[model samples]
Target chain A: MSITEQRPVISKLEQQELRRLLAENKRIDGRNPLQYRNISVQLGYVEKAEGSALVELGNTKVLAAVKVGIAVPFADTPNEGILIVNAELVPLASPVFEPGPPSEESISLSRYVDRSIRESKSIDLSSLCIVPGRSVYSLYVDLYILDYDGNLIDASVIASVNALGITKMPKYVVEGQAIKKTDEYFKLDLKDHPVSLTYAFLDDKYVVDPCLSEEYASDFTVSMTVKADDRFCAIQKNGGGMISPRRVIELLERSLELGKELRTVAYRQLAGGNG
Target chain B: MLRSNEQQQRQRPIVVPGEYVGDSKFHIPGLNVYRLSDRMLATTVGLVRIDGKRVDVVALKSFYQPKVGDLVVGIVKEPGTAGWTVDINSPFLAFLPLSEYPEKRIRLSRDSIGRILEAGTVLVGLIKDASIFSSPVITLKGKGLGVVSNGFLLSITASKVPRLIGKKGSMLSTIEKGANVKLTVGQNGRLIVHSEDLNVVMKVKEVIGMIEKESHVYGLTERVEALLAGRRP
Candidate 1:
């Protein structure tokens, strides 16, 4: 038997109520329009992985694990280490997720995270290089959606960033064409932190960190990633609805502010020791 | 071993899947508890309940299992020539046949069925038949069973339905009277809340959320009553 994603049916009355609540700047969960749900970050959750983190945003839970290995660099970027991001919407996480190959949604999530991390230059890729072109460290960030209550992109980003921040790789020595491993290990050098903020636009009104029901009711969503230095690293708009340029700018400013707050929380957890 | 009456008075211990609940010799394995040789192990995350000689695990979170005569709030998924496919927040989609509808003899056409109950139309119904081999059949002929036109729907963990209803529907009545709203609770954890004031609806939603989260805790009813009276508990 084949398993398929089942979308929760939203009654017309609920939809109407959701719109009315948005007009009044009130949410069903009693949060303000620009406020995010409670965020909790746990580092080093997966002991076997080089680094791992579990982040819970409200009811949504995402786990990220980083596995580092030595591999030859790509032809175009021989000196820079490679970072591969993969996301899986685990079937057990939600009724809508099915066990199969990565869907378009998961692919888009991975790509969005990849752009945010790579474009922001969070990790010093040059430092991971064992040799100029022969061998370098390759980091694979695998994100598993443990619970999908919506705002998955932001939750995944938080987990990935914290996982990467605590990542430790075994030291390697260059001996001519080959690289030799050493007993010593060093933490991955992270230069910057990037946080993503997503907003679900319910008609003209928008809410930050929308829950599952809100996400389903929303017309479209815009996700903006900001670097620690207040730079816009990546921006993505999903769904069929369109947004005016003015709203986009407004969202960007909000993202910048929210991004700093998110970074503080992530860093505080990272510094407070493993959970 | 069975606990003494003094120990039984204490709160039930929460258990995770595969945890050793008790020995099968002293207590018979019940719901969500599997017998591994002579030992009973919990098969799901839940609270352990030992009643007489039976040990059962009441799951904290689970899908609703349909049973005959149980009231449910269902959303119409698709219309067929004979009936409509309805989602009842269960693993199996329940079926609502045209014959089961309260209406008199009507032509068997997809358009006719669609016009009667289109996709996403929320309604309350009774499970007429439930079996493992096929989808459960629901009937709308019963009183207070029909299309839910105005009220919005809210859902909590299906396992906590009993807690939300409370002893002899005491908790439900308290919330209804306190917030001035009527709730049509489904056995499947869905609730259709009827109220004229949006503020009352919000209060009901908040109270339900609190109950769902703290259903396992002791003295929850008293705290719920305190919260309803506009006092923080």
Candidate 2:
């Protein structure tokens, strides 16, 4: 599947025309801008993967998998187990993507997901290092962009984090230098959980969760990572037009307010409840 | 866009980069400028820059960047006469030349690259170039990035490979200590364990399978090792 094929091309002129409709409180989908497209999450889809999930926001779809293994430590930090994340915008997900390594866009999206979990202090990484300076368990989170509509980053992050949240680690022992596995297992200790929210500036207004067309014509985009305590762990912005100081303040307040609801939805899904 | 004096004053505290502001939970200190479409926003956390006017955004996790010289694992797909195409978990399929393996080199009048490297063959390779057109490119020119022989393949989470390796090979040593196995890990989520003892291979496979399912927990290594100890044959 080509990544480009998953997306519907809308030129700038076409976007402007759509925006005109949006300005009148009319969207192509005939809904308010703040209203999200349909959102759904499914877990345990990839039978081969230890843990897998699929998240769809409207037409965009992302598949996340969690793989486990033993690995040597990085040079800088030998004692701690590490977590790595990689994302692919498969040509099947959209036509713009070519079959190769990850694009910068895919990399950034994975990093964004990684940062929220890291900075929120969700999982204690230090505990994952089996033998400090000698051994550790490496967890790999691979995300495949199966389809592209809009709001992929948000969908990807939610699916990945929730998948990790629901994962269970096996019980093991290390006698001297030897490590062995047991039948027992336990779930991860997720403290002070975090989630990310995406906001788009459209028609000179900030909207939550823009679909493909609104995303196309939006003035700027902001992604905010909020921890359980509602602290901001990370934030990023993109656009040619600079946001005014007032707009920035307004956006932050709005994000903070919306994040609580998003977090609730994520937790319910992570807890195996439907969203 | 217009801002009142009070709004500008409130913004003054947010202009600095990496300065903690807002409430304890919402604070990121200073803000950095990032782009979306053609619009730019001074933000504190969870945003990204993209080409064109439309930008994508997400929360920031760790700051690990993709680089050359990294060891990766990929799957062989789309085969051609010149080379067999391998999907390295990136956006592109890495090419493995038949010339690289002088021992297994077979010549035929017909285009038969797929015969040598059929689809689903797991391989280990080095990231010779990560910024190839539309995706990263890998090469099998080195010692380890070639056909993995005499091993049972296991799939795990891709992110856990680094942690399993541990700082400077410590974690690998722990897993290999008693198992007596030659294990090869690929970044794209393929693991090959070679051992004469099927029991030991099965043990390692169980550990990896557990890790794949539970690597997101706080203490993954201990959990994996504990599981191994209980099931030792």
DockQ of each: 0.56, 0.01
Model 1 chain A is weakest, by summed lDDT over 10 consecutive residues, at A266-275
Please give the distance, in angstroms, between residue A115's alpha carbon in candidate 1 and its true position after superposition: 1.0
Name model 1 segments beyond 4 Å from true. A1-6, A268-275, B1-9, B13-45, B48-56, B103-112, B196-202, B213-218
Show model 2 residue runs off by greater than 4 Å.
Answer: A1-9, A272-275, B1-233
lDDT of 1 by residue, B127-176 (tens): 99999998999999989999988877889889888889888999899898
TM-score of chain B of each: 0.92, 0.60
lDDT of 1 by residue, A1-275 (tens): 44333457767667777788889888877789988899898889999999999999999999999999999999998898989999999998988887888887898999999999999998888877878788899999999999999999999998999999899998998777667889999988777778899999888899999999899888888999988789999999988789999999999888888877777876676653321
TM-score, predicted candidate 2 vs. hidden true structure: 0.51
Fnat for model 1 comes to 0.61
True contacts kept of each: 0.61, 0.00
